[model samples]
Target: MDKTAIKKFAVEARRSLIESIRLKAATLGITADGIQAKLPISTGDVEYYVDEQGGISGHDIVKRQKLVAELKQRARKNDLATAFNDLIEEVAYTWFNRIIAIRFMEVNDYLPSRVRVLSSTENRNIPDILVNVRDVEEALGGFTASEKAIITRAEDTELPKDRDAEYQMLFIKQANALNKNLPYLFETTNDYAELLFTPSYHDGVIQHLITDISEDDFNVAVGGQVEIIGWLYQYYNTEPKNTVISMPKSHKFRDTEIASATQIFTPDWIVKYMVQNSLGKYWIKHLLAVGSLQNESEIAREFNWQYYMPDAKQPDNVQSKIETMDSSLKELEIKQLKMIDPSMGSGHILIYAFDVLMQIYESEGYSRREASESIIKHNLNGLDIDTRAFQLSYFAVMMKARQYNRRALTKITHMNVYDIPGTDDFKLEDFEILLSQLSENSSRLLRHFLQEFTFGNELGSLILEYSSSLTSLREELDALNHNQLSFELIPLLDKVADILNSVELLGQKYQVVITNPPYMGSSRMESHLLKFAKKNYPNSKADLFAMFIERWNKALVSGGYNAMVTMQSWMFLSSFEKMRVNLLGNYTISNLMHMENNVMGIAFGTAVTIVRDYQLPSFIGTYHQIKTADVSGKIPQHLPIADNRFNRTNQANFAKIPG
Candidate 1:
């Protein structure tokens, strides 16, 4: 894909979509105030209500309800934009689904005969069935007529004059089916269901859009989607806020905006460096322990690892260190070796990790199909605060898996990827129940402790177990086990499970942690997020990325590897003295590549630092500085540390210098 062209299209598409939605919203009179109008119910019957009318007049409950009804009626008649959003969302999902299906069919020969039948068909029915929308009514055959009518009305309907309404209905059905069939794609409440309605999507525009982009263009293995979407988000949010009167006030600064403003897609070379040094290094060390590699030099050559090495004067000591290091091969299993990107915006890091992990699995004689499934099921994990990020990441990872095994999605299993908590339906009260079980005698103390508990604790442990159990239960439900009680608990369980998964992410240790953590100063952070960071990570609170550096360390197991590309501020800034001290005290810097500002088309100075989560005395590592300007953005990949263009240094000596 042409990065520049894709980025341009994404920006224009987002602008056009938002404009169309806002115009439709204005026509429908669906303002924030309009949506918040009181219903025809007493205050005692309702939990909350907002008054739009000024002064005491707004307090007239009966009149407010009447006004709300009128607003709703107007919205129903004219508010095509809100419905359009939903249409666009559904269309986007359907488009991606088609892409996945087409790709799967292309490799249908690799699939089981039973599953191949589903993909080989070319009609829309095949795509519909693949996405699980076809026969939706029949699947719920046991329901009452009225209930069935409601379901049918929501999923399948036709409004000849109103294209938008028809599109909305089509999307409702498609989205619901996707949620039912492929839970990974439409996990949780479908947030995109209410954006806008498009009437003419099926009238060639959708085909044109799909034709404009090729399936091969959606490169999940690199940073294609991340770069394109990141640019679109930035352009959308930064556009003039007052250009459209119909734009909801709440839409101006949203979580998506935060994602756009902060996200920077890590370059492919950077991703390679991080994965190679962290995951690659770990594997090589394991090979040495297993007597797979004859010596340190062979290990370095075989793995193409340039980071950790013994001092030229003490090669024997390197052997002794490897012998003394933990020889537990359990951690070295390609299936069990977990790699995570906590700030996984679009999953660029995790996607690249997938590629590296596949190589390791293949090297160990695992077939591509087994390796792909194992990677998705056990090795790869990601979490992003942005819902879009999670969606893209989920799709990207699944798409990558499809490349290896066309039948991968046929297996009823959920990917380990997740979004952060706030986006989900999870509530604080859910945790209250769990905490109460932990300590009924001192609820206050438990609450206080829970508040302070960040990750990698008892709460995290429970969350991991809960998440696994919930996943198993969900699989059972999908397998046609219609236990009423189990079904009833699924929603609550989902909420608690998501909460636990998020918490567990912070608490659990990973074999490799790789990310380009979001870069934003405390000043740019939302007030609540800033306050939380300050409380949780005081030493590294000056910047969000710095805080993640601390969090990443906590998220790693003893001797685990962490690789990150972050702003170079922490290295020399006075405020980061404590962070620097803490990091040096606990971790070994395996390799450092300090690049001059604008080295990789980014305006800020950046450094790729690879660290091991163990503190080892007499550790010798490599460091290099790139000083030359390269407009091509490929120098980092092509240039070797031995190149004179790089100012090389001993990592140990570099760390010894004062901040």
Candidate 2:
């Protein structure tokens, strides 16, 4: 469409969308005089129309302008919901590229192809083709010219003989949608068409789609997507099909099973609260002290959040997730606060850290770019036994930094986390290859051999699994691939073992450590991890998180804090007396947040204990004891729970003794 045609259509579409918005708002008793919406008048209720082919018709542009006007008016009136929706529609429609539109549809089940585009109107226009579902049509609407050509060619052919005509028809419909919509957008459509029209293409695309979706849902965060993108390029992988396209690794699709399990996503509201409470005045104070800012009042005005906030839908949430730990910290003067999550599953903490730093930048006057650079350079770090998790953790950390500066995202690179100094390292690429090979073709003889080598040897099991690829290995079995694999299968397994050991030595220094270490009861502990732990702490008994705590105390500087979330059993269990004694003798218990009676909805009781290396002024002791009257009126002795975050003052007959 010419610019004028596009502009005019944009206007009409915008007006129609606005009318729909108005009508909806009226239902909510929000419209002026509670009248039904009419055309030619602008209200905050603007709608967006994306064509069946997914492009904004000329009508959409006009509606967008009107929507903007309505939003400004609404903002003046302080009608926040109306104003916010108006602004969202305006922004989504204005910058709504086909890629992002496709992405939105890909994730949200509610977004129909003809539904008011991207949080615009809730209602939709009925399409001429009720034949295909509106969702499919919407998904197909964004196809390119090459995609269209592929469809035309497919229509002319006697193909997909193994599949039913209805299946073929759906495929053709999808192809046509691509063709109609994706004029200039889809790259390498010709190559993909060749794959899709062929049986190999059908098989390849299906398998690839299943593989990506499954792997992604398992744990692929934004960084995992980056790695996948890089791998696709490195391996010359193709799109699934000409019509049924796969989301790029950069686009996350939680696996079906995992997605259905529970909402693992940290609630944005909860995240906001955490960021607000944790960072608080520390950010403001640090910003002034560092001279990053003269005061806190300049925060929202100077930072230009649009640059830092990637998803416009949740600016406040994003901001909350990443404000500074302490604004009082200066870029030049702030002491480095190193952290390590030994288990480091999917880098949640690291991602949170990024948000914290961004807020710090906001607290100061630093632009998003300046603040991001400083944080990545100085404040963040992570570790994991699983290489995939390690790569993912790194990816998350870098992505967090990149959110502040896209250019930096490009420069972020991946290196094997196990690569340590003065060691002939094992390459992850080699291990990944072994896994792929195992997936492609593995003999029963090989399986039997691996089971023997891996069973009771968790690391070996992990190697066997990784050797099997994401598709072949069961989810629970995937954890075994971290360290132990059959030595015969990957002759360099021993070398990799050496590298892991060296990494442990080299990575002994860190200031703060936090993690949700995997749980293993004494009976259930995998043989390898159990053996390793026993050898390391010959006389002590503890859980995985406690072992890590001991390691962290050894690693930290005198004043550093080790904050942890761990099971409550560690507090009073007689088995952990030795471990407790060692901890109390070596570290000062600073603060504790205990969730008694399972207050946090955590199935297992847990607490956050802050232990510092410096000694406490009082010998509040090696062990804390308390006495309480039971409901039966019997007196019972009470002791400090595992890490002593609980206050002993409230409980009567309590004692604190030195180790």
The sequence of per-residue lDDT tens digits that candidate 1 reaches over residues 1-659 is 55555455554555555555545443333444344433334245332332322222222333334434434433452354443343343334333333333333333332222222222234452223223433344432234454445445644553444434433444444444445435666442333223333423433323333444453454444433333433333333333322332344343223334555566777666777778778877877777678777555675556565433422332466536635765765346776688888878677777767877887888889999988988888888887776566766776676567667766656636887877644212234545544443334434533433343332211111122111223433343245433643433455445444655665565567988888887766665545566666777889988877887887777777778888899999999999999988888788777778877877567778998888876754566667676546435553544454554444343456566867
For candidate 1, what is the TM-score? Answer: 0.70
Displacement of the residue 154 alpha carbon in candidate 2, Å:
4.5
592 in model 1: Cα distance from truth in Å?
0.5
Measured against the true structure, the TM-scores of the candidates, in listed sequence, are 0.70, 0.43
Q: Candidate 2 on 292-359: residue-level lDDT in tens?
A: 66644466335322111111122353334323332324543332555454444446655665676676
lDDT: worst 10-residue window of model 1: 458-467
Error of model 2, residue 373, in angstroms: 3.5
Off by over 4 Å in 2: 1-332, 362-365, 387-395, 414-508, 597-600, 617-659
